[model samples]
Target: MPRTTLAPTLALMLALASPAAATQEYILPTLFDVAGVAADDVLNIRADPNPTAPVIGTLAPDATRIEVVEERRGWVRVNTGEGSGWVNSRFLTYRTDVWNEGALPQGWQCFGTEPFWAFIPQGDSVVLGGPDTPNDMRKVQSVLSTGVFRDPTRAVVAEGMTLVSTPQLCSDGMSDRLFGLRAELVIQGNQPRMLSGCCSIQP
Candidate 1:
């Protein structure tokens, strides 16, 4: 017939160690979906965070997997072609089901201009293509990361190439779409070549 109580310090430690306390912070360069907007309307991407800021672009009501690279006040920043724009965070919803461990997020793709090329991960292999080069399939050697889920940097090693991406603002140089990751790719051969570009998790 005895009751026990945890000491205040121990209780605090326990609380901090709980699953709730260990929840992931919404880091930048993360994905979001358009929400709370009328299906007939579009979510405006403003040149600034203010509501009256110039409307530079818009996202469809059903838009999903949008890469938000920065956040301030009640607004989020996203790439809009050659530049970036701000959108009201109230109209956006953070995506919960995305990139985990060291695996590439579904729909992950990277591309760059000048020497336009594309890198796509498909299950256990990767598809590398470009305007000047034919599409080639390469086996994935490994996927490496910092091991922290909220950390948004990762590397994918394939048969003849390695791609490393970091959570940063990246522009495709010819699109109105912004990207969340800056990618550097290296292809091995008699003459090794390196390329740089932007990456997006959106399909």
Candidate 2:
């Protein structure tokens, strides 16, 4: 390359490497891991994005695969027991392995009350069990989602069931744990029951 062209090319490369360009790739509805806390210490979740905010909950020092819903002023919003809280972003490390191309994350679980139903994804089929329905496995058909890479809306279609999860605050109604995604499951049968619940990427 000529000297005149080299300067502009080098400048363009540096510009793309800047922090501003990197921020575009960092989006919400992503996973995070607890970091910078001692083994005996716990990370506090506050009610607001300030140091003096009321403490809402705490996370174990070794907690991993935490879903962060939003970020504000160096604080990241995470779901705690039945609610959302903010934690200092400095203590959480982002995870690169995220749900992409409409694929569900590993160990994804969905459950609901008012009949007590649960959907568990196994190797190639989805195990659906409830108090009323028979415990049966359905073959996986396809997973679809929005075009945006970071969007947290996805649908899992099977032989007789379609499970759709969207980015929203959800509660199990019995537990104090808040959830980042709201799940709706439709079972195609004689009755065609529709169930609503919450989902979590964490265990």
Candidate 3:
């Protein structure tokens, strides 16, 4: 205290206040999407709300099913089937309308080429085959024809994984068909790691 300078004292105060200032809270949007990553780098899925936390798992580029749990200080808590962890908020995008309507469950990442025709189940993996007929049941048969059907013998779907399924249509063949075939695909390894969007029938 004998030689305390104003500059040094101010610096000390700033440092102590930095932690509190860095902590911020944001309301999470209903449906969020993660994109813009290469298909190689391990998307670090962390346990704590901070990036410095221990890595619990990694998300492949083609992994589309991630459920977000909570948001704290620019960090989002999400579930990746294997466990729960945090991801930086910068990589996320939110859709309130879709989420509020129960179209997308909480903690799950909703994605599709079309807005609302199809979505991947949360915490599951999907492989994207080529584009298919929009909302057409015949496309499901086509995907199966490509030999991407779910293999009961394979382990969990991983990066570079592809699957084909014709989900039952939820609506009558009338205004806005609600059902269509979808290919949930995963792309991992190498640069640009990412979980691609679901390629489905057009809406």
Candidate that would win on lDDT: 1
Which stretches of candidate 1 lie above 4 Å from their native place?
1-6, 38-41, 80-83, 175-177
TM of each candidate vs. truth:
0.84, 0.76, 0.34
Instruction: Give me the displacement of residue 85 in model 1, in angstroms.
Output: 2.0
Write model 2 residue lDDT over 71-124, tens digit each, in one string. Answer: 789998888866788999999998877867768888677899998989989988
Which prediction has the highest TM-score against the true structure? Answer: 1
User: Which of candidates 1 and 3 reaches a greater TM-score?
Assistant: 1
Residue pairs in clash, model 1: 79-178, 81-175, 81-176
Error of 3 at 56 (Å): 0.3
lDDT of 2: 0.85
Evaluate residue 128 in candidate 3 and report its C-alpha lDDT on the 0 to 100 scale: 30
Cα-based lDDT at residue 171, candidate 1: 72
What ordering of candidates by lDDT runs from best to worst? 1, 2, 3
Residue pairs clashing in model 2 are 81-176, 82-176
| Cα-based lDDT for every prediction | 0.86, 0.85, 0.43
lDDT of 3 by residue, 20-127 (tens): 565423233223556666777657778787878898877665555344445679887665543457788777665333322212233332244442333333233332
Q: Is 1 or 3 the stronger prediction by lDDT?
A: 1
For each of the candidates, give the backbone clash count. 3, 2, 26
Q: After superposing candidate 2, which stretches have Cα over 4 Å from the reference?
A: 1-27, 38-40, 54-57, 60-62, 70-72, 79-84, 131-133
